[model samples]
Target chain A: MQSTITGKAYVLGDNIDTDQIIPAQYLTFNPAVPEEYQMFGKFALSSVPASQAGLPKGHVPFHTKDEFVSDYRIIVGGKNFGCGSSREHAPIALDAAGIEAVVAEFYARIFFRNAVNGGYLVPFESVNRLCDRICTGDDVKIDVENNLLHNLTTGEQWQLKPLGEVAPIIDAGGVFPYAKKVGMLKV
Target chain B: MPAMTMTEKILGRHAGRDSVQPGDNIWVDADILMTHDVCGPGTIGVFHQHFGKNAKVWDREKVVIIPDHYIFTADAMANRNVDTLRKFVAEQNIKYFYDVGTPRYKGVCHIALPEEGHTRPGEVLFGTDSHTCTAGAFGEFATGIGNTDAGFVMGTGKLWVKVPPTMRFVFHGNLPPYLMAKDLILAVIGDIGCDGATYKAMEFDGDGVYALNIEERMTLCNMVIEAGGKNGVIAPDQVTLDYVNARNASGKKYDVVTTDQGATFCYERVYDVTKLEPVIAKPHSPDNRAYVSEVRGTKLDRAYIGSCTGGKMTDFRAAAGILKGRSVKIDTFVVPATSEIAAGLKSEKLNGQSLEDVFLSAGAKIGQPSCAACLGGPSDTFGRLNGPISCISTTNRNFPGRMGHKEAKVFLASPLTVAASALTGVIADPRDCLQ
Candidate 1:
């Protein structure tokens, strides 16, 4: 895992569920297949309502038409981010779409587990709500080592809650590798 | 030693520990790991990826595969997903593979699990679907997991879990005729916002809870995930024992555990069921709740009764009672959660006519037993809200685009409410149509 992640941030409102992150319609594309996995990026967040797609300003697409990857590398979200469904595809979709980190006030349990266990993205809980402060398409830097989110576009910074116990797992890249590292699984 | 709640007890026993508490991450063995068509292929891919292409599962009998979601569709990929499950089950020689197009085929994984006796008391069950918490009704620690965790469990028969502190929700008094478990859970969710129980266990207790039948108890546990609950549990008693004993095909022994006396709870709530009225979760969110009377006469384009949450024998019977003599004023869809429930719709009668007859006479379109249009699978999925419209449904969720079109609105209600609203072409109170 990189200590610093710098990218354009995409802002979204609260309760951005799995359905909106990657609609059920696109779930048929198997993530295990490299081609189908890449297809997830094309339709990621396609079901988020147009008005709620991008915060502050609306109707902003997470990715350009037919593209598999997004220009944004980080996501800024409100409370209850990833609140619905146990679909691991939600995190896989975000990862496939080029998102490296998601900073939210809090997250639904299953989504948080999937994001970390799957090693798809770094799910950071901000000390305070950052969705209102971060604009979509703003340049942001996440200093994971220092637990700080620097909004380069706005020249403001905020503290992120420490990753705590799960940091080692994330650093090892998902549960499987972590298990092997901790001697839970025989290498 | 500190007293442990039912969830803590189950997790501790599975972890081979005498004591476990909230926030303590421990490795626990899984009694059953369920995977359905939607996530099965992905899980299999992961299992094979890390464990080796030819490596065998830790225990073939412990893995149960059910192909339910996106079934009965012509979509090539959807069909192929089930094929993947079939091939893996054959190669692994798993004991509990309910394949599509076979007599053993079940409709929805959550409902089918209890029916097949896989959901036993004092067992830990992990499934790839969020609603797997439904099995907690049988005094167990059951929760949803992602494919990666499930794959790990598949390979090792164990996975790490953080014990969740239990929140006790004791329901007092009998539920009024107009009220169902759906209404009770909706009330709880409304009181505490969606994320209120984000990582906690919700333990349902008191007279009002046990009074409900097994299916209704399952309904109560089913939506705990909606509030971000890790699991929902009710202490197993005669009602649970009777159901489990009758259905335990393997005759597997399971310990019936309960919250110890004076157990600590992080939070507690009490609800008088008799005081509760018919409630509905309005569009976009499950916690956005309203009394049916508050939304009376709200126009609806469709009425659907189905899914693990609503499509059970009890749900269909309640819906049938309201639809027996009346015809629907709007598009109405009735889907049983499993094939057994579908057969019940035919053999089970309402006033001498079968439940299926009641639904058909009421102008409801009956789809094959599956999760048809609950999560809005394919464009061709039956009962899917393809157009922007308002619907009253017995489904668990009302998230945006949950049913079909991104702009479509879904109001989550009980089967009785959905049937009543179907007759009126609007969101009408079930009490108005109940007799």
Candidate 2:
């Protein structure tokens, strides 16, 4: 099974964390806040709008209440996604963001498992030049079946693979669904 | 008659086939299973769904439950997990219950198991947490399981696992006075990279293993997953057997498991701890090993000194001794591993110095038994843009934003190192602060 999403290509530095994905203070509040308002609540993302976009102001963080929330199917980063605590919230926050896949140079074990278990297809992929080419909301086409993520805007494709023994689960729409069927059976 | 490595011997017993070889895939029935609140509730939920009702447990006594993760209850969900396990414990009639607000609060499952005498050497144990392998420090066969496998164990007290290849880490030299097991493991992580031991059984042997206390050994095994090990263990020798004698003073039935020499280690990694200084994993990555001296000047917003990894009576005593004469800088939290440790810290005297009194006098906010900042399940938020921060902690992992914010740096250090950093309010080598 494969899918694709076209949107702006956003670039973040290494060590992007759950706290940055969704700050703890904002997580305590109702997740119903509009999406833009919820982003980087503890710290704002520079000139990103807070009022019009309704993005979180003053570190409020990853507001889920978003209408035009771009379906982020691909993420490219330096190293270590979900490397910190086994929060499970990191994947949850990404799932809520409509992220279908994350591609990183590397990953922390717990995060990798949590991502697969949550039905988020996070592949370990790195490209030399893709970092500078993609921008926020650039409409990328991720060829999941072939393990290729195409930056639609830049005509660039990257490589990645689902972790060992975890690929099938993500294809099945998360652990809950996978557990309901395949995982129940003894291999 | 030939000798086998400790891992090979253990695997040979459970090999269940002709000549159980290293990396041989085999399924061994688990002897014990433990879970904490953070992952416990998830396991229970999944277990209830599959069983639709409580299934027959292979051994009720062998299964244990501890609500150590979300001790203070960050939110309703955390509280709900505690209640979920509590109800099941009562319904299943499981007697080994370590509750909150007790000296037996059981900080982390691994720390609690050995201290409470729940696990014996040589038996394969499964925990619903990555650090569960800490039990291996006592020479017990232990490994961490996901929620599904954990749920399977909760219902049946058994689960499946491939017999992992043996990776022996032989430390032969005398460690420096300041350096300990954590440093050795960190240095190993530095060499092997984080994923060095994936799908392998790490057996720590040699005189170095003999020198470390169970607490120190637990520290070594605690971060095994940081290296992607299927599990990590040590041979049960006198140090291990004696520990069981003291801990299981109840005279409960005991089972012993050990590996023999000639047992091939698929890979052997050795370390010399003689010149080891307190190592810290820079924030956002447990494998980000750096000498404390290299990152010493890193300023910290919050200094935390507790977790299953760091929160022990011994660790607290060490921290307190380091801070005996000095007061903690503003914004430092010294959380005990568990309530019992907290209570014990009150009377624990490190080198003739009363730590509980010393720390209390220094106004260190003593936290209850729970996985405080290490797992980031709760507050004590540290170094941030409001102010650049670096936290030196006794807990495991320093991944970005682990302490408070992503940018907020955290350094994984020994308890003594964390204590010194707490006093200085910056990452500091304990050599200067310790007497």
Among the numbered candidates, top TM-score falls to: 1
Query: lDDT by residue for model 2 over A1-187, one digit each (tens)?
Result: 3665444344444445444454443333322223422342323222222221211122222233453243344555545544433444455555555565666666655566666665545555554534445554556776656666776676766665644556666677655566557544332
Give the number of the best model, judged by DockQ: 1
**How many clashes in each structure?**
0, 51
Clashing pairs in 1: none
The local distance difference test score of model 1 is: 0.93
TM-score of structure candidate 1: 0.99
Report the lDDT of model 1 for residue B50: 90
Docking class of 1: high
lDDT of 1 by residue, B1-435 (tens): 799898988899899999999999999999999999999999998899999999899999889998989998999999999999999998999999988889999899999998998999999999999999999999888999999999999999999999999899999999888889999999999998788899999999999998899999999999998898999999999999999999985999999998999999999999989999898999999999999999999999999999999999999999998999999999999999999999999999888999999999888999999999999998999999999999999999989899989899999999999999999998899898886
Tens-place lDDT per residue, model 1, A1-187, is: 9989999999999989999999898889888888899988888899999999788898998887449999999999998999889999999999999999999999999999999999999999999999999999899999999999999988999999999989999999999999999999983
Query: Reference contacts recovered by each candidate, as fractions?
Result: 0.82, 0.05
- Model 1, runs deviating above 4 Å: none
